[model samples]
Target: MGSDSHHQDGVGVPDELDRLWTPHRMAYISGANKPADGTPGECPFCRVPGLDDEEGLVVHRGEVSFVVLNLYPYSPGHLMVCPYRHVADYTELTEEELLEVARFTQRAMAVVRSVSGAHGFNIGMNQGAIAGAGIAAHLHQHVVPRWAGDQNFMPIIGRTKTLPQLMDETRRLLAKAWG
Candidate 1:
């Protein structure tokens, strides 16, 4: 066969595209669960507070803000600190809410390090949809744990992330460590 020759396998016809099946991302991509009108009644962040810890994947809850595991995690211990209010902009936060969110972010970092032995972290918030906020209606600070060589070829080349642990288990560990 020549170098450019193609052969058909039993599975199906070969194509130029490389597909990685990640059905879980459809909801996010399709915006199926995004808030209908960017209000507290429709915002998932607002609704999350009402659910229990396991159900919500909540690591810690403070007076004004709370920490929850990211459903679409960048890493095993990725988390988000969000205020209970349905405000979208950072400047919308009250003094108490701002302080609590900052405090929760710090606690989340400490708890994740203690639980997962993370070497470092990426902490920030995406301001708007243009800024890459999946849910631009709500303000959330992302805390993504980083290891020495955690950035592997899978995510870069194959567009896949290998999470070593499940969200519930990670949440349990961090919650325990936080308290």
Candidate 2:
């Protein structure tokens, strides 16, 4: 259990049990949960503002919230609307933060539609770790674009995803559309 490749010779476990390894989400699953002290250094939402826009992949910067391309995306043009503050719960957001987060989310949808021609979107957040949140300590709203044939066998059969555009290119296109 300690190591990633710790499996028996198909003896102990049943054949019905399947495992999908997502090593990319390790940075969030392992590190982000431990920063309940609410320190800025440990919170990625807090740290991103200090970096340049292109380096951070920030699509648009609002007064109290900002839209950034998801590092681990479900689809192309996947975005996260996050507050500048390191608040965890949705109820914790100030009126300004609340307003900006919602406004930014709306703009994100439009940008995705214009830039990528997305058929639909999945826009929500997993509140806590038990609720499947990778970074439960900081609040972030996911805006994932969905298409007709996105749910391919690659994710199920092969544990891999094929993105249509590079993250950097997607960011540039979204940023342009945001304007």
Candidate 3:
């Protein structure tokens, strides 16, 4: 799946997944591209509250901030804390909004730790699309749970990263933590 090859969907194959299967490579490559809408369209975190599932992947939701599991995560228990209002940069957030974001971020880390038995976490924001933000229109803080020996040869050698647990299980654990 080198860049020279054309994917079935007609996009250029990413070089990183040259030896990987189509479906797996596709998922990784897709993250590199921007969404067609050019905007988040609707805030996913904000919409979760009105949805049927109260104990959804969304462990917490506040007036101006919320936390949800990352669908495509670096780790199984990965989550993100995002502001309800759409903003591309942290500078756009008001004092109250920033406060909420920080509060949710801390809460998300606590939940991730409790659920995943993680020793530490990588928690930060990618400011723009160029800075590796998958959703450029909305600034969000990622909370990636980490273990002592979690880093392995997969990502470095095989260009693939494996998660130890399922999203559903992670969601269940975090939901309990929220409660």
Best model number under TM-score: 1
lDDT of 1 by residue, 106-143 (tens): 88889899998999999999999899999999999999
Per-model TM-score on C-alpha atoms: 0.84, 0.78, 0.73
Which regions of candidate 1 are displaced past 4 Å? 1-22, 152-160
Rank the models by TM-score, top first.
1, 2, 3
Q: In candidate 2, what are the lDDT values of residues 64-85, reduced to their tens digit?
A: 9899998878778989999998
Error of 2 at 128 (Å): 1.7
- Candidates 1 and 2: which is better by TM-score? 1
Query: Whole-model lDDT for model 3 versus the true structure?
Result: 0.73
Question: For model 1, what is the alpha-carbon lDDT of residue 119?
Answer: 94
> What TM-score, to 2 decimals, does candidate 2 have?
0.78
Task: Let me know the TM-score candidate 3 reaches against the reference structure.
Answer: 0.73
Judge candidate 1 against the unseen true structure and give its global Cα lDDT, from 0 to 1.
Answer: 0.86
Q: What does the lDDT come to for candidate 2?
A: 0.82
lDDT of each: 0.86, 0.82, 0.73
- Model 1: weakest 10-residue lDDT segment is 2-11
